[model samples]
Target: MGIVRNGHEASDRWSYIRRFLGGVAGIADDFLGWWWRGKDTLSPAELAAAHEQWADRAEWRLAQRAEELASDRIKRYLVTSWTDSVAYTSRRLAAQARGELSEWIPQRERRPDLHTEARAIFADILTELNIQSQPTKEQSSVVHLRKAG
Candidate 1:
């Protein structure tokens, strides 16, 4: 959540209204609310576009944060691990032998966190760094009537 302050209101006409707006996640109703206050709700297409843009920025933020916080050695190890995972060598070899098309797609065989690698990594990094969590310096992407509508 973010606050919008009007320094020079000039008696501007604005109404504060919030919506969960789970449409971006393709779940119109969920506990994790995509809460944003605005004069109005966004059109479906516009909401999707906004989600895409926001997600890209969020990913970049995570990458930058990792580089800043992790040691050079840890960073190198992470780079190697990520690259190796993308190659999926076992699947590649399997495909060469069995010619299974599905082998091309990367699969997480067994993980503590099944659907979310980010959750696992977040916990791992925090443990390694001896920190609980770090708040983002940037403000949340609080959608507004202008940013969305």
Candidate 2:
């Protein structure tokens, strides 16, 4: 009775997420499918709803964010973001394969530790690009020549 109380399941479970579960993705999606049981089966109607509810918006959000960044900075900033993701993924895969991740990463400090890792990688790339050493030019500037008698 205590376990099956009303509103308990409703509050604890996000039933809507079931709609999006499928072979549509890679490792993460596969893991999710494995985690879900018979009762948590995905329905066809819900799958369509999931596409309408989240997937479409995710694509739109990606484009919108790219536009916002472009308006704020140069295209290189966008390229840097892509490179950062690639570099971070490669580092994480290598560390995970080595099985030494736990040695340096505490379960409790995981999020912050990962963030620090990514930041260090990004900083290294920035240094390699020599971006920090360059100074920005002013919009308006004039060269003055002195006349000698």
Q: Which stretches of candidate 2 lie over 4 Å from their true place?
A: 1-42, 48-52, 71-149
lDDT by residue (tens digit), candidate 2, 82-108: 434433443443344344353444322
How many collisions per candidate? 0, 0
Per-model TM-score on C-alpha atoms: 0.27, 0.23
Tens digit of per-residue lDDT, candidate 1, span 1-149: 34333321211111111232222222332213443342126454444433443333333334545655476644544544553453344334334434345434333443223325555666787796774353333322443434775
Error of 1 at 39 (Å): 9.8
Reference-based lDDT, each prediction: 0.39, 0.40
lDDT of 1: 0.39
Q: lDDT, candidate 1, residue 118?
A: 54
